[model samples]
Target: MKARSFRFFAPFAFALSFSFLSAAPARAAGPDPDPWFGKDKALHFSVSAAIAAGGYGVGSAIFDARGHALLLGAGLGVLAGAGKEALDATGYGDPSWKDFTWDLIGVAAGLAVAWTVDLLVRGTGDTHPLFTAPAPGEMKSLGPSGLRVVF
Candidate 1:
């Protein structure tokens, strides 16, 4: 096509294409448009994990029992997630079960990591260091005395 004809055709074609796009039905906004794996979900997960791990460390320091520490960590994590949801329910933001689910998963992951670190640092035996030899009297309990393994 000639330069002049090409210029005229180009504008007409562009306008025609846009007209078709505009004719399509518009999407209605209701629930969140964010995907499950979006940045928002990542933030939620990371924040909950940090909270839970911090709580676990603090709880471990305050209480001798691992169970108490576990409860503290899980409670803090759950409280954080639930609090956010409750705030969203109050019209502060969009409430999402997906975000809460991610938060729960993060909490679990954080607790697992913290628990592993504790075990490594504190050791399951009388000695604090994981690689060290067990105390003399403690060696007697090493065998299959009331121990069970499941696959």
Candidate 2:
């Protein structure tokens, strides 16, 4: 009986002691916080740009379409940003729409770069793999092309 009684009162005593521990008083209302330049925003942009470029490159290689690559990369980038914000909302950190906006902008810029490179690779009218002509003075025969495998 004594053991059982102690167990019940022991929890109550612990809870009562915890109730006595007080937190610091809240601060008086102040001016709105100023927006500052954040390094984290820069990192968010750069990392998103790199990831978007890679995603576009790989998607372009697999799909063989610039528009498809843009869609795939942008969609993924936005989804990733949204997911990150959602994770932040879980109380680990403060979430911001501005960060996601920067991500979207970076993704668009990176996808544009990927598209331009793809165009350069594909060339205007040539279907050949060779990006450039042999020389201005010499006429060269097209060499055998190798098979490309994409996954």
Q: What TM-score against the true fold does each predicted structure earn? A: 0.62, 0.58
TM-score of 1: 0.62
Best by TM-score: 1
lDDT of 1 by residue, 1-151 (tens): 6998999899999999999999999988897586889898998899999999989898666554565677789999999999999999899999999999999999998888988999878766433333343333342222457642211
**Candidate 2, backbone clash total:** 0
Model 2 lDDT at residue 109: 82
On a 0 to 100 scale, what is the lDDT of residue 35 in model 2? 37
Report the lDDT of model 2 for residue 126: 35
Model 2 worst lDDT run, 10 consecutive residues: 126-135
**Candidate 1 error regions (>4 Å):** 1-32, 126-151
lDDT of 2 by residue, 126-150 (tens): 3222233323343333235544432
